[model samples]
Target chain A: MTFVIQLMSGLAVGCIYGLVAIGFSMIYRAMGLVNFAQADIMMIGAFLGYAILVAAPGIPFWLAIIGAMLGAALLGFVIERVAIRPSVARRADQVYLVLLTLGIGIVLSNGARLIWGADPVVYPTGLTHQTLTLAGYPLPAVYLYIAVVMPALLVGLHLFFTRTWLGLALRAAADDPDTAATMGVRPALATSVSFALASAIGAAAGVLYAPISYVSFDMGVIGVKAFAAAVVGTLGSIPGAVLGGFIIGLGETFGGQLIATEYQDSIAFAIMIGILLLKPTGLLSGARR
Target chain B: MESKSPAALALTGIEAGYVAGVPVLSGVDLEVREGEVVTLLGRNGAGKSTAIRVICGLLKPNAGRVELHGERIDGLEPAAIVGRGIAVVPEGRRVFGSLSVEENLLMGGFAHRRGIAPKLDLDAIYTSFPRLVERRTQLAGTLSGGEQQMVAMGRALMAKPRVLLLDEPSMGLAPMLIDAVFDMISTLAGKGLTILLVEQNASEALDVADRAYVLERGRIRREGPAERLLSDPEIRASYLGVG
Candidate 1:
């Protein structure tokens, strides 16, 4: 029961990490930029949902999530246009892009600090109170919600990528933008769409995560862990992101339980390094590169 | 204002290179009429590929006016150029390593399906390349060089382009494979496709060209009918290697 309980909690957190990792993978695959601001977008999403929910106090949870997603997607589009597009036009080096995203992450963190103050905002009363008994262990209802919903969302994304024309274009554009252009897929449009989708997915992960954990400006650290997840899963493959998330989550949970709770954060990264050293492409990577 | 010409694709005064003020092509002019196979023949580093890249809108030329079917297309985005009915089989057989052959071809049909009815669908493409039909499920990265070249050409044809630009289609291929590729080029021309072929294989290119231009150091050294160049002593001695 203890093992199952730890596994359940790990998986719930892993799904959130996976959600953010999917954004990282999508953007990186398409544009070859690691997008350090991705995690900060999650922080923004959590705060936005918190603000909206607090203002009404009667608004449904799902509606709050949808609103946060749309708002973050728009914000992401603006960021891509204002910050990213110009550098890309100039054909700036990879170091410049990485620094630009890091700068954006710092700005977002400080901006959130200015808006929400330095303290952690507690999640809603309803969330902490709800619990579900599974396999003789009492687990948070939010974990169950995350564990179930994230897989479904991933499945939907898989269908979208395989079946839709836009999705095919995105995959093609990622491989070779010059060639994709010759096929009539606009590279500019594809780049923007990738930003929008990545941001939306990152925002969704944030909203889903906040009810289980406290919302804080510093929570972008979690987003960085998601980056590790993406790397662990192979940077470009979608399935790799999802599976890498679970692996990181489970590793942290089990490591904390077995050894020292203080080393939990370090364990996720350590496992990432180990995996990279051994199987660099990740556990479920569909992409060779 | 650019002149309205009936040529399928035309380039005038095209000056371009990777670095500024160090052009590989200076004052290069070329044109391909409808349903004609025009060969750009040159020695290594003679700006043949550069000329094709300029017309394809990959590199923005320092000074040039490229027109397709009487409309200017030089400064347009590469995607828009494709929409205007120009496609390129780039120098390397740059097939998407991760995608299946079928998916690669499907991506090729992207421009053709742009909110309009598609002219060259998957069925037509598979029929044109029966080898591709057999290997449709295979990943492009795993294919042999000849098969990869076929995938690259098949991918280009998915757009049903009005003008096709081929850059060194026989590069790195065996002699047998080169002969087979040139045969395919002639066949494509026989079916009425307008093509701009860039090659170092001077003899084979001339064999398939209706018109030919010899480029040397970013300038057109000579231009004439393909048959006329075929018999020229200078061309025979220098390019044809008939010592």
Candidate 2:
């Protein structure tokens, strides 16, 4: 019963990491760059949703989520255009992309700090803090919400990629930008669209998380786990990202439980290094290059 | 006897090179008439592939003009040029290795910005490459070289290109496979597709080409009807290694 509880708890958090990892994987596949600022977007998104919900108390919590997503999408699009695209046009080194994103992460994190301050704000997600007991084990209903919603969103994303033309165009851009261009997929458009989609998803994770936990500036620290998940799943694969997230989430939980709690973070890193030594391509690497 | 059709694609003075100091294409000129198959024949390092790159907007020419159906298209991006109906089967059969055969076809169908190409669909592509139908779910990188080539060609066809540019379509293929590829090329031409086929195999290229241009160091050294070029004793002996 404890194991099942731990697994569910781990899965709920893992699904959030998985969502953020999807953003990282999609952006990496499309632009050949790891966006370190992905988690920062999560923090900012939560704040935006929180602000809107506070501003209009009568609005449903879901409306705040939609508004937050729209905010993230527009902000992400602008960031790609203003901050990322010119550096790309200049044909900067791969390291430049990493550095640029890191710099952006610092800026966004600090900017949130300026607005929200250093304190953690309580989130009124309107869900009663009810605990559901399964076989004498207590489980937070919020985790159940994440467990169901995240998978549903992942399925929706899969459908978008496989069934829709624009979604196919995004994947095409990731596969071979040059050949994708020959198929009339504008690399710029693909990049922008990817940024928008990724940021929106990141924001969605943030909104879902804020209700369950305190919204704070350093919430992005959790993003590092998601980044690790992306690396463990092989850098650019979507399904790999989700699987990696779940593995990391579960591993961290079990590691904390069976071993020492303080070493949970290191478990993800240890697993990453172990996988690198054995299968450097990652457990679910789809990249041939 | 020249079966008359207007030039569907044309290039003049296509000066291009990857490296700044070395020009791969210098003062090259070529054209493909509507519903005709034109082969750009050259030996290795003869800028045949570069010419295709320039025509397809993969590489910009340093100095020259490219036109399609009498409209200028030199400065446009590859995506826009693709939207204008120029599709390329690039050298070495550059299939998206990670994507499935079906996904590859879907990628190829991204030839338009908004909608699927009406002339080609998953079923249509599967019909054209029956082997691909059998292995639709398989990853493209795992396929044999000839199979990869079929996917590459099938991908281009999914675009329903107005001017198809094929770069060294026979490279790294078995002799029988080369014949099969050429037969497919001829079949595509028979269906009124305008083709610019680039090849190092002059003999195989000439067998299917309606007109031919001999590119030597980025310049047209010889140009004529394919039959005329094939019959030229000195040309055949010097370039094609036949007499």
Q: What is the iRMS for every candidate structure? A: 2.0, 2.9
**What does DockQ come to for candidate 1?**
0.60
Cα-based RMSD of candidate 1: 2.5
Q: After best superposition, candidate 1 residue B212: deviation in angstroms?
A: 0.6
Q: Mind giving the per-residue lDDT tens digits that candidate 2 earns over B1-243? A: 554533689898889999897999888888888888999988899998888878878899999999998888998999889888899999998898777788888777775435545334778878878899889888888999999999999999888899899999999999999999999998998899999999888888999999999989878999999999999997789777977
- State the interface C-alpha RMSD of candidate 2: 2.9
- Least accurate stretch of 10 residues (summed lDDT) in model 1 chain A? A280-289
Tell me the tens digit of each residue's lDDT in model 1 across A2-114.
89889888998899999999999999988999999999999999888888888878787777778888989999989999999999999999999999999998999999999
- For model 1, what is the C-alpha lDDT against the true structure? 0.87
Show model 2 residue runs off by greater than 4 Å: A128-130, A133-136, A286-289, B1-6, B112-121
Across all candidates, what is each one's fraction of true contacts kept?
Answer: 0.72, 0.74
**Top TM-score prediction, candidate number:** 1
